[model samples]
Every structure is written in structure tokens, then in C-alpha cells.
Target: MKRRRGSGLSETQLGYLMVMPALLLVILITIWPVMLSFHNSLFDYRLNDPTRSEKITSSNILMESYADNHYYLEGAIDNAASSTENEEAAAEVEQFAEQYNSYHEELMSFDGVEETFTTVEEMLAGFENINDNELEYVEVDNEFAEEYKAFLEDSAESLGTYVEEGNEDGLENLQSYVNSSANSILESNFVGFENYIDYFQDSRMWASMSNTMIFTVASVFFELVIGLMVALLINRSFKGRGLVRASVLIPWAIPTAVSAMMWSYLYDGQSGIIAHYFEQLGFISDTSQLLSTGGGAMFSIIFADVWKTTPYMALLLLAGLQTIPSDMYEAAQVDGANRWQQFLKVTLPLLKSAILVALLFRTLDAFRVFDLIYVLTGGGPANSTESISVYAYKVLFAQQNFGEGSTLSVIVFLTIALLSVLFIKLIGSDLFDSRTPRK
Candidate 1:
């Protein structure tokens, strides 16, 4: 007999209803912000603006803003000015006179003089007497024309010399002029990309990147090696093994920031226990300071990370170790395999999947490392500990350059995504498959 149809929701509809909450959450938390960031990346964004609106939205405006702020405006301005010929020079003179008259009117307004001076018009009519007969000239109220002329002459001479030598000094100077002019046009608006560019081009970026990589690789590698050894030792039945296992997990269970702070105190040269011990052991000449240098600061951070993380690695591997059957080791021993051979042939091969999972999690965590470095060195000693995240934070919030800061963030995100994909392809995907089946 055919069954009667129930309330009639299809499987697809039920599935959609089940996932509705998660889908809504993904849009709210991830998709919306990503779309907003991409939209903001297209414009010139300044963080200091409470509104977060782009004053300049077009690519032309964005490029112009960047060029103006970073002194990259010479090529365009020079090209435009050079395209004019002798025929346009007379027209340009009249235009310049009109602009000067407008400026003079504004200046007079500032002084409470509402009426335009007829004498000023008469003086302007005698433009022939003006040096070079160029309308670019303007009469100053209380300024030395000779000094201005000398200044222009010196600037021109320097620019010529720079061009002859193929130096970019002239270009930089021209770009500065453009920047000042553009800023004036924009009513002295704060364009924050200047500081962002400075931070990006600074040596601090490279120093931080290098320090982070070294700390991450060294700490993770050593943690894996040492954690494995500890796991193996603790896996065996022994007196006080439960206490030893709990003690090892204590470091891992402690908050990372708190542990870093504790280590910082220990590394303190004046009153730190570790520093005093090192001095007594003759490892250093004195305990005046331990983290003053770049090397010392990096070592301190790495040591703290390894100390806190190794127990976690050991625990993860130990879970896998417990899953291995005792018969494998017995058979290896029966086949006359030594301890080293048994480890290489039986333990390591059996632990491949667990090791890969541990490494994957640790490596990804290491890549975006910021807090430990922040607490330990505060990206100090000339920013030797400045990770990309910290640098991006300073640019976005401190220097208030949202556009460039977003650019750096996008770069870091891409780097992490690529690394994660590579890790999965290399090891994560095949981790379980690599394990040998038990007989």
C-alpha cells in the first residue's frame, strides 16, 4: 500500500531551513565585511575621518591622491605643462593676470577693503615693465622680490643639475609642489596615506617579517621534536607518570599572554631569575639587560612560545600514541628490531596522521603571530619585532591610513590562504591515507 504524504516539506527545503542560521551568520560576519573592504580598497580612505566616507572615489582621484601625498606627481604635471607652445604663452599670460587679480581681491577682502583699487589695475596695465613680461609675476604687499627671485633661480639651477645627473630629486621636488597645491585645493584635508607609505617602505617591515619567520619556524620545529620525545617517555608506564603528564600540560594550559608577561619578567636583566642564573653560569658578562638587542629579544620571544606550546604538541601526539596496538611493538621486538628501529619502523609511521594535524594547526597559528611579540618586545628596539599585523594596525589606527593598511591586510590574508592551501595539499589531505593498516 502507498504511504500517505506527510506535511510535505521536501528534503532540500528541510536542509535549507537547517542551515539558515549558519548562512545568515556567515553573511553578517564574513561576507559583508569582505565586500565592504573591497569597496573601500577602490577609493582613497583616510582613517581619521569619523564618517569613513571616501572624499575621492574615482580611480583618477585615488591615483592622484596617492601621487600627491607620496611625491609622485612630477611626470603628469611636467607633461601637461610641456605640451603647451609659444602660441599659448600669450593666452597663458592673460589667464595668469586674471588669476592674480582674483587672488588680490581675496587678499584685500581679508584686510576689510571692499573696494577694488583703480591704482592696482593701472599698475597691472603696465605689464611691460615686469621682468620677463610674464603674468606669473605678482606684486607683493610686504615681501622682498629679490629674495623670491633668488630662491626661484636657485631652485631652477638645482633642478637642472638634477636632471643632467639623471637624479630623481627634481621629480620629488615637483611632486612636493603638486602635493602642496592639491592639498590647498582640497581645503587642507588630511590624507593619511603619507604615513602609511612611510611605514610600508621602512626597514621595520623586513625586520619584523624576518623575526616572525625565524621565531615561528624555530619554535614549532623544536616544539615538535621535544614534544615527541616527552610524549614517548610519558607514554611508558612509570612512577609519578600521572603527575608528570599533568605538570607538562600546565604550561600549555596557561594563558599565552600571561605566560609571555611572566617570561618577560624572568628575562629582565636587573632582577630576573633566568638572567641571574645565566650570569652565574658565565653565559653572559652581566645581567644588566637581556632583551636590549635584536637577537636577545627574538630569543626571548621564541623561548616563551616554545615553552608554552610544546606540551600541547606532546599531548596531541600522545593521544595518537595511545591508539597504537601493543602487538606492533612486540612484533618489532620479536623481529630483533632495536628501540631506534622500532621507533622508525613502528611508532613514527603509525603517528604520521597525528603529527601532520598537529603541525598544520601550529604552523598556521605561528604565521599570524602578534600578541607574543607585542607583549615581549612591543615591536621595540627600532621595531625589530613588528609583525605585519602590528604594522598594519599602526597604519590603520595610529597613522590613520585605512587604504594602505587595508592593502597590507589583503596581502597578509592572501599569504595565509596560500600557505594553508599548500599545507593541505602537501600533507593534510593524505594524512590518514598514509597510515599503514594493521594486520
Candidate 2:
């Protein structure tokens, strides 16, 4: 006997099973990045900072710092012993110096630590930066690490006391050396929510966010209007219509960075062909004003974006228009409906799903605008065109401020999520709701 397919699973159940792989893939690509950024944002992680180069949750020793400080510290302690004139003071200084050396050697005696320490020392002497974590950092027993770190702190206090008793040139330097050594045992760097709190006070972050919203709203609105018109015009039969459709996609075909660069030269104030025409047409005071002023630069960017993406919007709308049955238009016309009435009554209602989908894509894409603006303007003429994505890029990669930059990245993700939710709830509800069977 042949076995029944899908066993007892209904169509809905099979549908869910069919889509599981896609859902898993989406989560991996989308949610994983946000979670990673959130993890980094929790700590004071920065590539520029040796102590905070990674997301850490426990106390650890930076062997590199320890080695460097100990080298200077050993000299400072000897200098202290030699500089003291009084016999009693010199004996006390010598005793402390011996204690410090003993502790330093004991720390090195930890399993495998001595070898790592030697390698680090040799590398340091060569002025090499220890990029390998195994060579630079070590996790030790908390109790042992704390005690050793405390001993270093106490050494610093003792040196300060020596300084107070007599103005010794070497005592101050020794105290600083002990303090630096103490810092080699780094405390846990898990600073929760501090990064999120910091963004509230970040003025430039807010400016970039505002710029993103403006860019999204303006670019999408115009793309919709212009794209709708192009789709309607192209939907009708005409000579060389296929050729026109192919040619219309050329602007969108260009890579975003290349298009932005192409437009940059075209928007040049004094010599740009586009800028010259706009100036000659009396649209501006001068050709140079296209990229020199805040408003003009923003306008220039928006104009370029519209030129590059209008074809995309048209393509999406055209697909939707084709799905529309011509019979409905004929019926509307038979009922004495004019061209305008037929569009308003039959066309728009049927095209709502397409409109919603197109808006969703374009809005998110425009909100995350970076390469276009980055190449064309580099967020300048004083950063007037900087989007949150571009700002995040500068912070994370340019400044190497990973902690603060991760927070910025999380903000962008959250903002995009909010926009997606809004679109789904307000515009896409009808489109998606129809999938459910009626009671």
C-alpha cells in the first residue's frame, strides 16, 4: 500500500514546515547581527584600547601591561634604594624592592605563564604589538589575581609615604610605576546599559537620525509618485516599449557608489553639466551652490537618489500593474467611469498590496542610505547629509570606538524594526490579514 503524503498534517502545517528553513535563515542573517551588536554594546569594547579590545565579563591580567610596567618598575625600585641617603630609609626601600620582585616572579611561575611572559618580554623588546590574545591576556584565579593586584596597590601607597617623608626624585616615578602595574589586572568590563544611556546625550547621533528620517520620507514619497507615473506610461503598448523599459533601468543598474560618484562630478558647482543646466535654467544662484550649502547639498543628494532609484520603484509597480486584470477596467469604462474614475475605483484598491510592499522596501533601503551619500558627499558640507548608517560606519570603523559604535548600530536596527512594524501594522495588515480563513 502507498503511504499517505504529509501524514495527518494540514496545508497550514505543511506550509509552516515548508517555510521553516527560510525563517531560520532570516533569523540567522537578521537577528544574529543585532544580538552581536547588543553584546558588544554592553561592554566598553574598543579596538584602540588594549584593556577593552574584547567583550569581557571577568577579571583578567594583561600580561603585556604587566611586562612593560614591571620592566620600568624594577628600575624605579633600584633607583629608590640608591637615592636614599639615611641608612634606615635605604634598608626599608631595599626590603620593599625585594618583596615586589618576589611577588612578580611568583606571578610568572603560574603554569605556562612564565613561557608566555618570556615570549611577551622578547616581543616587547623588539617593539612588537602583541595582537594575539594568548600572549597578551591571561585569566587567573580571582583570589590570587586580587591579592597580587592589591599588593601592587599597597606598594604604590608605600612609595607615596616615602615621598611624603622626603622629597625624593625617584619615589614619585616608582609610585606611578606601581599604579600602572596594579592596572594590569583588569576588572570586569561589563558595563550594562551605560552605552544605551550615553546615546541620549549624543547630539551628533541625534542629528544623523534626523537626517535619516528626512531622507527616507522625501526620497520614498517622490519615488512612489514618479514610479507610479512611469509604470502607468510603460504599461501601455507603444513602439520600442521593451527597449524603453530596458533603457529606463540603466540608472538603477549602476552600483550605488559608482552612481553617487558619477553624480558628484555632475553636481560640481562650477563645471558640472547637471549643475550648469540647473543654474542656466535659473534654478540656482550659482553652479557651486549645488554642493557648497547645506540645503543645496541635501537637495542634490535627494535628487541623485531619486534619479538612481526611480526605475526600481517603477519596476515593482509595473509588476503589480500587470497582475491587475484588464477586464475590471473594461467593466468600469462600460459603467460610464472615466479614466480617472476607473483608476481611483478599480486600480488603486487592487494595487494596495504592491504599493505596500514597494513602500516597505524603498523606505528601509532609503533609511539605511550610506554608500550613496558617503561617496557623493561623505556626510558633508559639514555633515548635513549624514545618515545614521554612515555615522555608525565612521564610529565603528573610522574611530575604532566599538562600544559607542555598537550602541549606534543597535539604534539603527531598532529604528528599522520600528519602521517595519509601523508599515506592517498600518499599511500591510490588510494585505497579510487576508491570508487567514474567515470564521
Candidate 3:
């Protein structure tokens, strides 16, 4: 008997196939980036250095550099030899070329590298861009690569001084030409695990991590407290409850950047209402001290973040609140439970999942806090307020150190992952089980 095309598949298999697209999308978008970042963290990748701009794990020869520089070097040597016209100078040029040729031959001896090298040279001579990366670059043995690089650098320097002494005044440019020739054949920039080691040794990195933790803990704690109060207040059936609920969300609805800028103005030491009030209220000894002192700046950051994001916490908790049946509260009321007792016995026990969700989100959000601290404190007062995200941004973009920045990024990802696991474990499997739909 002929079977239908899909008859062999089970219902579970069909369900898996149906969801595979979304799972693949998540892996492609989220997991792939993190894996790329992890890969980048292995080497000393930098953007400013032409040779190291890309992530190269293996020993690679920079053929374009060798080709262009060798061409110039050969021409410069000939020009210096001819212009000098002295037997001793000619002998010197011969000696320099002999040593360079020796190393050059060894480099070319690698199978197929000679062909690529010649092609690159021809393209360079024609003023054509070396579009084919493989042609412009080739693999070399790690040991040979290092030896060749060191040899070129030494020869470029020594030949510069030697040729300058024996050449004519008109040939002064030959020395510079020879010296710069070494730049064409760049060495392997791969420094495996060095970036991580350096970051571990770095005090600034640890300090930034510390600051991130402080901000996350402080902001999340305050937000949870204030948000819970707001959630409870709005959860009640009072007059104009709709208006109150809408008003409560105003702070969270504003864009983060706009909120940060607004707080920046409000935190201004001079002629700012919030700062002026804080000074009068004795929160600070002086108004001008808010942004100037390290502790004060950290305080200002937490205050700003809490104010800007607490409404979001309230909103999450409110969703959780709505899920709990009113009968739970009514049962506690019938048992002669007070509002506080009812909340502790019925609300909190049931709201554990909601709390976990809110804390996980807010904690991660606070851990990665950038724009708020960036706009407010600018990680100032001697970088005392510098969060890990800000530090990563400074290293990745400001310093153009992609390898180290990627390491920092991986650290942030791992930290968030660890926190997520912690939250899930503490909340237990029941939290998720409770979220499942009824059959």
C-alpha cells in the first residue's frame, strides 16, 4: 500500500518541525553573535593595525606587504648601488641584497606562496587593488613566520644605516625606503588567551565590574521596593484607578536616552531643581558635589535609573498580580486576614514567579546599564562610576581593541547567563510548570 507523504511523522515530531524555524532564528540571531564574540576573544584583534584588523587564528603571510615592499626594496637597492658608483658601496648593497634574498627565497619556498607573492607583486605594480584575499595573503609556518618577520625588521634597520653611509647624498631616501620595507610583510598577530589574562590583571576591568554590580544591586533593590508599592496601590479597586495606572507608567514609557538626558539636567550641580532640593533636604552637603564626588555620582546614577525604570517593574508585577484569582484574597479575608497578612500569606506566595521575572529583567538591565550612566556621570569622578558596558564601549570603539572588547562582551554574557540560572534555580521548576496552559 502507498503511504501518504507525511504519514510516518508523529504529532510530537510535527510540533518540533513547526517550532524549528523559530528555534533556528534564535540560534542564528542570538547564539551566533555570542559564538562570534567568543571566537574573537581568543586573539589580540585590533582595528588600527592593518595586519590585525581581521581575526586570524592561523599563521598567515601578508603577501601584499611583502610584494609592495620587496618591489620598492629591490628598486631602492639598485638605485642606491648605481648612484653610489663606489666599489665599497656596491659591495655593501650586494651584501644587503644577499641577506634579503636569502630570507626572501626561504619565504618563497613554501608551496604555492611564490605564485601568490608574484601575483600580488604584479597587481601592486599595476596599481590594481588586491581584491582576492587568498592571493594577497598565504599561510606560513608559525616558527618561520616569526623568524622571517624578525629578519626583515633587522635587515630594514641595519641596511638603512649601512646604505645611508655608503650611498650618495641624492640617495638619502633609500634609507627610509629600506626601513619601511619591513612593514609590508606583517607577522601573525595571534596572541591566544592573552587578552583574557590582561583583563584579569587589569584593575580597571575589575573596578568597572564592581561598579556594574553596585549599580545593578542598588537600582534593582530600590526599584523592587518602590515598584511593589506602586503595584499594590494600583492593584486596588479605587476611584480613577485607570488614570492612576496610566500615570504610573509615564516614567517607564519615556525613551531611556531621553530619560537619561532629563536626569542629567536634573542632576546638574548648578541651577538644577533636583540638586537644589537635595542640598536643602541634606542628601548632599553641597549642590555642586553631586556630579563631582565619586560616591555622589554613583548615588545619582542609581537614583536616576531607579526613577526611570521602576514603573516598568510595577507593570510586570501588575501583570503577575492580575493572574492571581481574587478568590485567593477573598479566602484570606474570610479567614480574618488583614491587608498586610493577606499580602504575605496569599499574594507573595503566589507572586514568586512574577517577582523572579521582574528581578531577572531589571537585574540584567541594570547590569548592562550604559546610556543612563553615560549621559549622567559619564563614568566620571576618576572613572568611579564606569560600568562594564561603558568600559566595553570605550575599549571596543574608543580604543579600537576588538579582541579585549569581545572578551568583555563574553564576560557580560556569562554574567547574565549565571544570573539567569540563579534566578531560575531559586524560583524553582514550579514557576515554569505553573505557566503551562491547561489541556
Candidate 4:
């Protein structure tokens, strides 16, 4: 006599429901940042530029700047006008002030603007800095901003002329104030895809991308070859194998920045043992060439990267080597296959998945190489080793150009994404093919 229970979700639906939280977390962590970077890339955002500091879709007035400038502007203009003995010059100055006053009056008439302006004026009188949420950046009609900017520019020019000819007392300061006030009235900085277009045409961007490709390809290639050999060597049962395995991981275990710093000293022209040896071996004409020339710098970074990460690659491949059944190798030997033939037929085929995974990880890491190159070569020696990541960091932080930097960031993301897709496709096909049930 109990009521019948309704059916719950199907197995597939329940499975999806269980994973929804994790799926949302992954999206928030990965997709949100990429989307934010794309959004920033569409505008002319820069910290050094007050007008374009924030992403603006319409004309706006920075009330803090407007209030501060207006306070000084009125006094400057009045004093200059009163000081001029020439009736004509005085009358013209008065007319300019009147026009400016009318514009100010109109701006103050906007909703919430007058209230914010009054608050800012009060703060200024008290010599107090405006705190967050206390001041408001009021948006206005684009036409109005243009007109006000034009009027301020004209007023500044007239003031400059009056001051230069000694027609008015100290009008130069007033001219500067007027100019600053004009700048406070910002125009829409949003220029969709303009940053992207500019980067495509930029020579430095292409150069950085080329450097990234070269570093990625060379470093990953060497790591794969050397790592395979190391993995093969360590896979066999031998005395002190545990110690050897632990020793191999020392370089990989060191922090990248610290490793780079250590290598920087080793590559130093005057004191480094590696550089001295390279010189003695006739690889270079002088020890200094190791880090002071384009080829040498590229080689140095690749060598350092291979040395540090080869152990990691070996570890991954070693895991695959461990998974192979001992019987497979014994069976190959019983079939009259030599060691080399057995390795070619059995080891390589079984190790494919691990190799693919290692290559994918190493390739991505090398492509985004920044900290190592940044700390060591500093993208110097004529920027021959500057990776795209380093270039983006310089633009984003050093120059404070967020818009262009965001464009660079997006490009890096896209390139990494393309590489990931390529690797996944290759790996996915092999894995699925291998795991498919035999007919």
C-alpha cells in the first residue's frame, strides 16, 4: 500500500550528474581565464594611460581627476584674467572661462554626477584622497565627451598663446591644467581584435614565436632520445639500481629558477667550467660565446633543459617498461630473436603510449619556457632566446600594456591548445586501437 517511487535518472545521466561539480570546476579554472584574456585583448587597456586604464565601452569622466583639475583650473584662469592689463586679452580670457563654466554646468547636470562631484570637491578641500567606492566614474554621451574635449583643447591652446607672448601672467600652468582635465574625459577604448591584428603584423612577436618553436622542438627531441636510452639502461636489474634512479632525479628535483641560476654561472665566460671546456674543445673561439651569441645561447638553453628534464621523461618511459610482462621478452628470445630485434619488436611497441605522453608533456613545457630563459639569459644577447612566454610577461608586467599582452597570452594559449589537440588525437587513436577487443 506504499506509493510507487518515480524512476531516477538513467545510468549515463547519473554518471554525468556525479561529475557536474568537477566539470564546472575545470571550466572555471581553465575557460574563465582564457575568456578574460580575450576580453582584455579587445580593448586598449594600459595602466600607464589614465584614459585607457580600464576597459570602457562608452565615454566616461574620471570624477576624481575632473574635480581636482577643476579646483585648480578656476583659480588659475581667474588670476590670469585679472593680471592682464590689456582689455582685449582680459575680455577673451573671461569669454573662455565662461564657455568652460557652461560645459561644467552641463556635466554636473547628469544624474549622480553632481552628487559625486560635490563629494570629491569636499574631499579635495580637506586634502583627503578619494577612497574606493567613495568616488564614481560617470559615463556620459560620446558626443558630449568629444565636444568637451575639443573645447578644453581650444582653451589650452589659447592660454598657451597668451602666456608665451607675456600677454597674461602665468597662464602656462593654467594651460597644463586644462590639458589634464581634457585627458580625464576618456573616449571609448574598446577596439575589438585590433590588438590581435597588430600582433600578427609585429616583427618581435614573430621572432618570439620562432624562438619558442625552436626551443620546444630541439629540447623535446633531445630529451626523448636521451630519456629512452636512460630508461632502457635503468630498466634492467643491476646492483645499486635504486641509488642510480634516485641520483638521476636530482637535476629534475631542483627548482627551475634555481637550476637556471646555477646554469647561468656555469655558462659564464670568465669562471664557468662548462664554458672553459667548450672553449678548450674548440666548440667556440672564446668561452664568452656560450651565452653571448645567438646560436650558443640557444644551444645552452636546450642543453640545460634536456639535462634537467630527461630524468622526468625517463621516469615516465620506465613506468611503461615496468608494465611490459617479462614473458614477452622471454618468448621473443626463445623465438631466436636477438636483443636488438626483441627491443625493436616488443619494447618499442609496448612503450608507445608512455612515449607519447612524455613527449606531449615535455613539448608543452618547453614551448612555455620562461622562468629558465628569463633568469638565465634574460632574453638578451639581442633577444635571440626570448620565448613567447617571456615576451608576454615583459609586455604585460614591465611595460604595463595589458591589451597587447593579453593578445600575446591568447596566442600562446591557442598554440598550446593546437599542440594538445594534435597529441590527443594521435594518442587517442593508438590507445583505442590497442584496447579494442579482438574479433
Candidate 5:
């Protein structure tokens, strides 16, 4: 009988159709955000500073603040000129006002700016807020922005000297007006690859990366060893095996942040049982050293992480262990193979895929360690235990420096991507080797 062909789409097309939703979801969540971050990383974006608060590609005038400031600014400077007693200072202030008026006229003369300025003035007079971006910001030439910003800054500085010597009354207010107007003109903050360059040169970045590597390696290594031992113990038939497995998973089941906080108390210098025991056992010279010293803090976090995550690793391995048949051990025993020989010849070979999977998962997880370290040490004791993730969080949120923060985030993504590729290569090869039967 011929194959039924009700649908026109081929099998490959149908396969893609089935997976399209998942592919779209991944792009939406993962790819879209990374691309946005990359675009932001090119600029000097920050929320705290009004001048660089937005991602500007070219010079632009903040019409709302500028229009209001300019309305008062012109009158303020003219009033200062008339109110001053000193002829020299008065002449200088008048000259400054004339120069400023010329710059203002030049700025307004720019194509479309005059119309935008008129519209902005009308909105301000009627007390209507300029909420539309197109109406609120007018793009201008780079040269004019640079000149205008420089003139306002210099004028403010010169006016400050006059105010100090009592050369003019209201001179301070005039200076303030000049400064406010200057702030309304934002220059392009776009700086492609410069943030990356600076961060690569930064000592703190390298230090955090180094700490991340150390933590990943040490914690993963210990977890593998300890987890395998636990998996083997639990895999064997014994009374209360179910209870033992559940109890072992208690640490992994606890939320990372909560467990980290709990460990912080245990590692506390004063009135901590673990700290006291460690000190008495000659692990450290004093109880305070556990979280106080750089080496001690790194060691403390690594130890805590191994204790918390080993159970999870054990669970993964135990699943792999259960898949192996008892007949393999029986066959090995009939061949006069010792326990160690059976483990080496049969158990290890069969568990290769499981070990590779567990390693890859734990390695990636350990590399991105953040919350536990954050809650426990706060990346302090001189930032000796600070990972790249913690450093990125501080820059992104605490400092409100989005540009540099995004750059750090991109670095993290790239590193994680590279690590994933490496692991996948090893895993793919091992699985392929296993599937191909020996001759």
C-alpha cells in the first residue's frame, strides 16, 4: 500500500513545526535580552546621572527642562547684570549674557529646533507636560552640543568667582541657571568596546574571575567524590534505605539563600559552634578567621557548597546506578573478578554517561554561584571570594551603572557559552563511543 499523504508538509517540516514554539520561547527569553544588553553595553548608560541617563547616539536637547531653565536663565543673567555694583563685573556679566544669548539664538536657528523650541515654550506656558519623546527631545549637531556644554560650564565657573568676591547679587542664581541648562543638553554616551577594554584591564574583574574559577573547580571536584560515595552507599540494598535517601537530600532541598544564611551563623566568629570546633581542631588560628580572612572565607564557602550540593549530585548518580543490571555483577563474580575489579571493569564503564552528565551540570552550576556566596560573605573580606556574577550584580543594581554592568553580563554569557560547548563536546563523544558496540 502507498504511504498516506493527507498533509502536504513533509516529516522534517512537521518536526520543525512541532518544535517551533519552544524555539520561539528560547529566542524571546534568552536571545532577545542578550542582544538588548549588548546594545546597552556600547553606551555609557546610567540612571543616576541625568546627562547620561538615556542611551544617546547623537547630541539631543532635553526640551522640557531646557525650555523651563532657559525662560528663567535669560532673565536671571540680565537681572544680575543690572543689579551688580562693580562696572568691570557688570560689563563682564553683560558680555556673558550677550554671549549666551548668541549661543541660544544659534541653537534655536538649527533646522527644526526653532519649531520644537516654540512648541516646548507654548506647552510650558499652558502648564502641559511634554510627555511625547518626539516633542520632548530635539536632535542637534555634535559640534553645537560640545560648544554649548563648554560655554555653560565655563560661564558658571566665571560667574562663581564674581559671586565669591560679592561682585554681583543674584550671580549665584544666574550660575545655577547656566548649570541647569547645561545639564539639559546631553552628548552622545555611545562608546563601542571601550567598556569591555576597561573591564579587561580592571584588576577587580580579573580577581573576581579568578575566584569564580577556584570555586567552580574545588566545589565540583569534592562534590563528585563525595556524591559518588553517597550514591554507591544508597544504591545497595539495606534497611531504612528510603529514610537515608530522604535525609541525605535535606540539604539540597533547602533553598540556597536560606541555607547560605544558616551557614553564615554557623561560620560566625563569635558564639558559632562550627567556628569554635574548627578553631579547637587547629583548622584556623582563631574562630574569627573563618569568615574574616580571605583564604578562610573561600574555603568556608567551598565547604558549605560541597555540603549543600553533594546530595543533588548523589541523586543524579543514584538514578544512573539503578539502571545497571545485577546480572553484570553476577557475571563478573563468576569470572572470579574481585569487588574492586567488578567496579572498575563494569560499574565505572556503564556509569560513564551518568558521570559526564553530573559533572557538566555541577560544573556549570558552581561557575555561576551567586546567592550562597552573596548571603554568606557578601563578596567581602576584601572581595576575596567575589565571583563575576556578584560583581556584575553590584555594578548592574547597586551602582546603577547599566553600561558597564551589561558589559560584565555579556562577559559572563560568553564564558558560560564556552564552558557549555566544551562540556557538550566531551559528553557527545562519550555517548557516541558508548553507542558504537566494541568489535
Candidate 6:
């Protein structure tokens, strides 16, 4: 009988199937957002206001409506005041006529000036004849008369001036005023790319790039060194080795945001234990604020990064360490090789693949570091800690300059791609060669 083919899978197919879900998730979460961000960078997007919206257009209309209402209401109030003054003047004239009539009758009834009537006595008698209501009426009339005289004088002067000028330029002046107002309104409607250009040309970009490079290179280098040492030490048999390894991983297990926040407190100038201890040891001045200075801030960020990531580097190296054979070390020792010589010749040569892999992973991660620096310093003290990631974020989110933000992001992406390609060409292929099986 012919044997049936079983449902057995090849190692490569099995491995691919196992990673497919993770690969799909990576594309969905990381790659998709990056692609979306790139697309948005092409557009000049404003988050605060929707583009081409009816509400924005309506705002202009509402402003115009208010301006029109203000002008018309002011004109109406002035015209009403003028009409009231004219009515008051007409009433005053009528009152004057009534007073003149009464005076004339009194004068006619009296004998001639020689008929024993003194001027002072006649004035006092006329005042007494005026009733309280009539006196109040006369007082109000006089106030209006004074105000009307001033108004007429001012109006006459203005009218005379206008007549002398012949009002020849009034239409041209009005048209020019309207044209300027229209230009201002149009200017408000159109936005410019000056901010984008300024952001690209500024020294802030280069400064941030330099600081970021230093941070990434230094932190990755030291973290690798220390992590390799720790991994090597723990790779050997020891009591409670599992507990020690687990303890070391605690730093890495803590979230980056939480770790950064914890470090910020530890670096606090006033009451921080680290600061106080360092000061007591004379490592730094007592008055020193770690985050206040550029160098100190850089150091603080690097320290935080190493503290959080060293365990991760060690874990990677430890995985590689487990693959190495103990026979190689035993053989090297039988050849009269000391520990240092054995490490240099046997251990280091074997650990090259692990070191390169760890370096590559850590370097890329460090290059894109933002959380630690952001939480600790917020790119403060004159943007001393402003990485390319932070700069891109500020342009895209804070300034809402998506176009320029995209430009910066493209630059960063290109740089990372070039570095990755170069690194792979130099050492990555050999380091990850699967054809050569380890002993």
C-alpha cells in the first residue's frame, strides 16, 4: 500500500506562520500611522479650524454685519440728538415770545419813565411776577440756548472749511479707504508659508539634530558595554541567578513614561536623593540643578535611557550567550589562557553577532527617543534636549505646520534607512547568517 503524505510543516513555513500575526500588527500600528503622517505632511492642515468651512465664512459675514449695525446706530443716535436740539430751540423761541408779551403789557399799563417808577423797583416787581414753574422753564431754556449756539458755531466752521476746499478729493479718499480695507480683509483670508521656511532654515534644527545624535550614540554605546558585562556575569552558574536576572529586568519592565517620570523626580534640584548624594560627594555643586544646564540635561537623559534599556540589551546578549558552547571556554582555558585573554579571543569573537544585533536594535530605538527627554525636560532650557522626533512633533502638532513637519520626518526616515542599509552591508549579513550553524 502507498503511504499517505502527512500534514507536516517545514521549519521555515512554521516560523513564518508564527510571526505573521505579529508582522500584521506591526504594520497596522506602527507602519500605518507613519504612512498617514507622511500623507498629512503634504497638506497645510489647521487643527483649530476646519478648512473651507461655512462657520469660518460666516464669521466674516457676522463681522461685517456688526460693523454695519455700529455705523448705522451711531448715525441714528446723532441725528436724533440733533432733532431734539432743534425742537428745544423752537420751544425756547415760543417761551421768549410769551415773556415779551407780558413785559410789553406791563410797560404799556405803567406811566412814562417820569411817573415815579425807579428801574430797580420795576425789575424786582417783574421777578416776583414770574412763577416757580416758569423760572425752572427759563433756566432749562437758557442751557439749551448755550449748547445750540456752540453747535451752530462748530457746524458753520466745518461747513465753511468744506466749501473752501470744494470737497474735490472726498470721493477719491473714500475709495482709497475702501480699497485698503478690502486689501486687509483679503490678506486675512490667505495664509503664507513663511513659518515653514523659517523652521527649516533655523539653527534650532541643526542643534537638535546634533544633540540627538550625541544622546543616541553615547547612550547606546555605554548601555551595550554595561549590558554585555552584566549578561556575561549572569550567564555563569550562581546562587539565585534567576532572581538576579529577574531583578535586573525590573527597570526594562517599567514603562518608559513611568521610568522617565521617576528619573525626573530623582534629578529634582531641591530634595532629590541623587542630587543630594552627588552634592555631598562633591561630584557637583550644591546649587546645581541637573535639568537647568544643557550638559546636565543631556547627561540626565542619557542616564535615564541607559538605566531603562540596559536590561533589554543584556537580555538580547543573554539569549545569544546561551547559544555559545561551554566547550569553547574550557578548551581555551586548557591552553593556559587567562580570563582576560580568553574573553578577548574566545568570548568576544563569539559575542560579535549578539553585540551587533543589540547595537542595531538599541541604536535605532535611541535615535527615535522622545518619551524620556520629553517627560524629563520637555526639550526645555533652550531646547537642549530637542531631538528630531520632538522637533517633528512640535511642527506637526504644536505649530500645526504639517508640511514642514513632514519634511523633517522625511529627512529622519531617509537617514534611518541609509544607516540601516549601511549597517547591514557592513556587518548585519554576516551576523545573522543562518547557513552557518553555531557549535
Q: Which pairs, if any, clash in model 2?
A: 269-287, 269-288
User: Candidate 2, after superposition: displacement of residue 362 in Å?
Assistant: 0.6
For candidate 6, give the lDDT of residue 386: 91
lDDT of 2: 0.88
Off by over 4 Å in 1: 1-35, 49-203, 432-439
TM per model?
Answer: 0.64, 0.80, 0.86, 0.88, 0.94, 0.63
lDDT of 5 at 121: 94
> In candidate 4, which residue pairs clash?
none
Q: lDDT tens string, model 5, 140-182?
A: 9999999999999998998888889974557888989889999
What's the CA error at residue 370 for candidate 2, in Å?
Answer: 1.1
Residue 106 local lDDT, model 3: 89
What does candidate 6's lDDT look like per residue over 152-203, in tens digits? 3343343234334444233223223322222211111222444446656879
For each candidate, what is the lDDT? 0.64, 0.88, 0.83, 0.89, 0.92, 0.65
How does model 2 score by TM-score?
0.80
Candidate 4 weakest ten by summed lDDT: 1-10
How many clashing residue pairs are found in candidate 3?
A: 1
- Of 2 and 6, which scores higher on TM-score? 2
Tens digit per residue, CA lDDT, model 1, 100-190? 3454344345332222233333344563232321222222332322332233344334334434444444334553453343332221223
Error of 2 at 318 (Å): 1.0
RMSD vs true structure, all candidates: 13.3, 5.4, 4.3, 3.7, 2.2, 22.3
Supply every candidate's count of residue pairs whose N, Cα or C atoms clash at under 3 angstroms.
Answer: 0, 2, 1, 0, 0, 0
Ranking by TM-score: 5, 4, 3, 2, 1, 6
Task: Give the TM-score (vs. native) of candidate 5.
Answer: 0.94
